[model samples]
Target: MTGLAPNVQLFPIESILDLVTDGVLAIDQRGYVLYANATAHQLLGRKELVGKNCGLPAAHGVGGTDLQLVRRGDMIWAQMRSLPIQWLEQAAYVITLTDITERKRAEENLRITAGVFDNSREAILITDSNNIIVDANPAFSHITGYSRLEVLGRNPSLLNSGRQDKQFYAEMWKTLNHQGAWRGEIWNRRKSGEVYAELLSISAIRDDSGNAQRYVAIFSDISYLKEHEAKLRHVAHYDALTGIPNRVLLADRIKQAIAHASRDRHKIAVCYLDLDGFKPINDSMGHETGDQVLIEVARRIEHSLRGGDTVARLGGDEFVVLLRLEKDHECLASLDRLLALISQPITLKGSSYKVGASIGVSIYPRDNGDADTLLRHADQAMYIAKQSGKNCFYIYDPLADLRIRSQNELFKSIRQALEHNQFEMHYQPKVHLRSKQLLGVEALIRWRHPTRGLLSPLEFLRPIENTELDILIGNWVIMTTLAQFDSWRRNGLEIEISINISAYHLESPGFAHNLRQQMALYDIPLGGLQIEVLETAALADIATVKNIIEQCRRFGVRFALDDFGTGYSSLSYLSRLPVDVLKIDQSFVKNMLEQQADKTIVQGIIALARAFDRQIVAEGVETEQQGEALLSMGCEIGQGYGIAKPMKAEQLQTWHQPAIEKTR
Candidate 1:
């Protein structure tokens, strides 16, 4: 106040103090506020302060302390400092309050970050922009077996295991430079010279201009996890007992081999091998010995093949081999070697045992099939080898397999046709050739195929012969023929109907019973329904067939011997079959005119039928001359396309009248 220039007016001390950022106040010894600056009023959120008690601890001398002050119902941190001062010549003190909320928060965050960096389980490493190791955490030392002092000032590449190529590091750096961070798994060497895997995350500490200044890396050791995963992978792809590839890995190998073979225009021989006489040995000996036998067999197979080739166990005494071959003979040679080696005696537990292998091979590109198809073909061929005297190898024939597959598909279609009522019956007329009189009609089956139209019995019947379908079709024909006879009788056309039963159906278990059940369904005229049994059928069980024929005769039904000369039965056996008529096979009848032997055979059948006192019908009488010749031979009854082609039931009623007029 004494240092003043002329004409200069000094501002009040309280007003000058309000200009400072810190809050200032003057208080009496009793703690009552005497003077307060504008900042103090703002900090305390009160406009008036004089004569008011400042609710705070008494100031001890002149010192600084942190305090919490209530401002507008909110608590805030402040640095409070006091100074002993004279206010209006009375005892008082001056206090200054500085808001330090932001500083306190920043200090607390630094403490937490420091604690985390010190105690984290994950290894942390910090490097400068030049990739020089600047600092490392305790976890880094623990995981890598390197002290912090040893790593400082060195390049991070010191931990490289040399497993990754330069290009790998180049790509990683490229990603880091573009994105400011990179996270991945890396293989590195520890300080102890041991290789290990780790999941690592690296971040670039950038400045305000987004330029990288430092790199922070955090990683966790995963060596034990990798080892565990490898073990699991092996279990999945390998057989536990034999240590060879299992079925799953075999499939993968075969697929890879097929790809390579197709690209290189080579061949792969897929062989399915099964141990012969192994089950007997396994049953007689203990299962432990059986297991040992299988193990030895696997080892022999593996040793017999080339290095590139693979042998896989398909469980239980079965194993598969895949050979990469350049020629046909290579596969043969390998297969021969395999058989020889497997047949060698094995000595285990001081006992000598022998086993032979039957190997079936399907070659790739030649078979032109996928992995699964090739495996299946080889398996089928293996069975063939087993049946043809074990201890041998056979090559799969695709052509033969194709034929079997076609037959199976045809059988399936026939079954579906029966279930969907796609089958129908047609009748071909049998007539007295000399008198041109209609004798009866033979019932034939036709399949109304959805896609291929109607099919003849010749197209579908042969494949199902001796199978259950044959019996089913034979039964269907009989029932259908009986129903047609009833329909004809209702229409005032009473005619005899005959049906051909296959050899299987005639000899089936319930043939007699099933036939009796069908006959009872309609009012069949005496001898109006005839069951024509193949001559071969009767020859199968002559006594059973004779008894069946005699039993049917009691029910007013007649039986005929169909395809007569084909079976070539003896005269003594022929006389014992009590059939009413004999029908010559079409093969002999159709070619009799062209072939002398056929003519002679046909003549012999006619003579035999007559000698036995049985009526004869000549099948396949296609020409008028053939029909005349058959009549001259004392065989008057005939059926053929020359007489009348097989027709539906509706067409037959209309066709019979015209046929009778033409014959007359």
Candidate 2:
């Protein structure tokens, strides 16, 4: 309608309305479609709209109104605006519809976001690129104790608790700048100057050009959680009764001490201490008094040590002390102080109570063990100290402990061997050296160890000596020897058999009865079975041994004094042992050919045997010259490697053939 250039072509009103982005439709007053643009038909998904009725509100509306249009089962929002117009001289209202679906959805999303920002529990803070606070949610004001009006335009550093250094913030900002986001725990101060912990997440709001325009931080206060976690950690690591470090913490301290000691080239002592009379005190007195006493004791011990030293309770009356020392002797002074301090009477509930501490110290580098091993060694030594006397400290000896452990392991192996029938008898011939006659055979025990092969009595027997296992093995040897004797007799090879018994077994109750019963089990002749007791063993209890030998003699079980010269028993006592045979110890016999002193000792033994009216046998004869020397010394019988090595029963049968022929 107005200033149009003649050169410009004028388009139809329909084409002009179709070019508009918004859908356009014209409805008459009767709600009939008067005109519809291409966009309106496409938006409504209808091909024909000229003759159809288009629903419109009968009102003169100045502002636009929203209307819902159904298209393919989907409701579409459209904005309608009405105006009075004349169509073909008829009075009607023209209604124009515009599709507003996408804009409405965006407005709804913004409303929901705004609601979330206002009601969220986590604090939200928005800052401009220059790090000035621009906006804050209500949660931010509640958590930081700062009002929105007071915090706006201020930096987040205003709430710094100073717990974190500048480098921490520098690193946080560095991460945020590089990664566009950062999340971690941080400590901050509230408006009331109270410090608190928070789990904070910060994100950089970046523009399309990859430049940060603002920063948004979301955080939750974690101070209460942090406090609760600290309480749990304390309860876990500290003893409730004594208020000292418990075993769990003690292990950590010991490891740290070990590491420091190794690095500094110093020493650390792990001391295990037990209150000697604590159990009685806890029983006689009430538990309250006992608890008080323990607390006092723990405090005293903790204060008595150096600053770096640690005292820990391993439950009950047991406590472990970790001492870092420059020298091992330094620990001794501290331990002595501990014993004295613990011995001092503790007064509780108007009653004076006295309890002593038995402390065992295992020094690092000296004990040369791990933390657990050191503690165990100290515990073992503590028992030793308790056994010796209360109120004392004992230093652990790893070598001696190792020896005891090895002996125990070997004892277990030996016991298992006996149970599994791994023991066998080896026979060494006792012969007349001058006549080359086989007199009898001494039964020597050999263990066919599963892993270690054949083991001599010297290898495994000594550990069992004086133990109940000694009695069991001794009985086994006697029974085994008698059984072999029966076997030989059945084979027409009647030979006397002798077995060595430990002192404990000989002194054991019912020894004579057990031996008599065992001998009766076989068909051997009277005095065919002999028991060789070591001279040292007989000296253990001379009267008991003499009585045992007499009891055996009554049952035709002869006795021999083995290793004759090894014991320190008086000659008078030796004369009353009631043994029928004297076997010279191997030490003198083995060296007699080369040494005059050994030869003289051997000769003296033979003379004593003869004077005592007993048979004499020289052991460990290894050469013909030695055997000849023994024969010259008037020792007629000998048992040694020079004669014949100890052989199994099966081999002995074959070996005896040559000796049998010689005897013939």
Candidate 1 TM-score over all chains jointly: 0.86
Overall lDDT per candidate, in order of appearance: 0.87, 0.86
Q: What is candidate 2's lDDT per residue for 286-308, written digit by digit as tens?
A: 79988999999999999898889
Clashes by residue pair, model 2: none
TM-score of each: 0.86, 0.89
Candidate 1's residue-wise lDDT over 1-664, tens digit each?
A: 1111234354576457768888877787888887777777887888777777877555754568888889899887888888878866778888888888778888889888878888999999999999999999999999999999999999999999999999999999999999989999999999999999999999999999988999999999999999999999899999988999999999999999999999999999999999998998899998989999998999888887778999999999999999999988888888888998999999998999999999899999989999999999999999999999999988999999989999999989888988999999999999888877787999999999999999999889988889888988888888888888998999888778998888678778877787888989998879998888776653577788778778878888888878887865745556887888888999998888899999999999888887888888889889999998887777888999998999999999898888678776
After the best TM-score superposition of candidate 2, give how far the Cα of residue 465 lies from its true spot, in angstroms: 2.3
Candidate number with greatest TM-score = 2
TM-score of model 2 vs. true structure: 0.89
Give the range of the ten consecutive residues with the poorest summed lDDT in model 1: 1-10
Off by over 4 Å in 1: 1-11, 25-36, 40-77, 80-96, 274-294, 315-317, 340-348, 351-360, 379-395, 486-495, 523-529, 533-580, 585-602, 658-664
lDDT of 2: 0.86
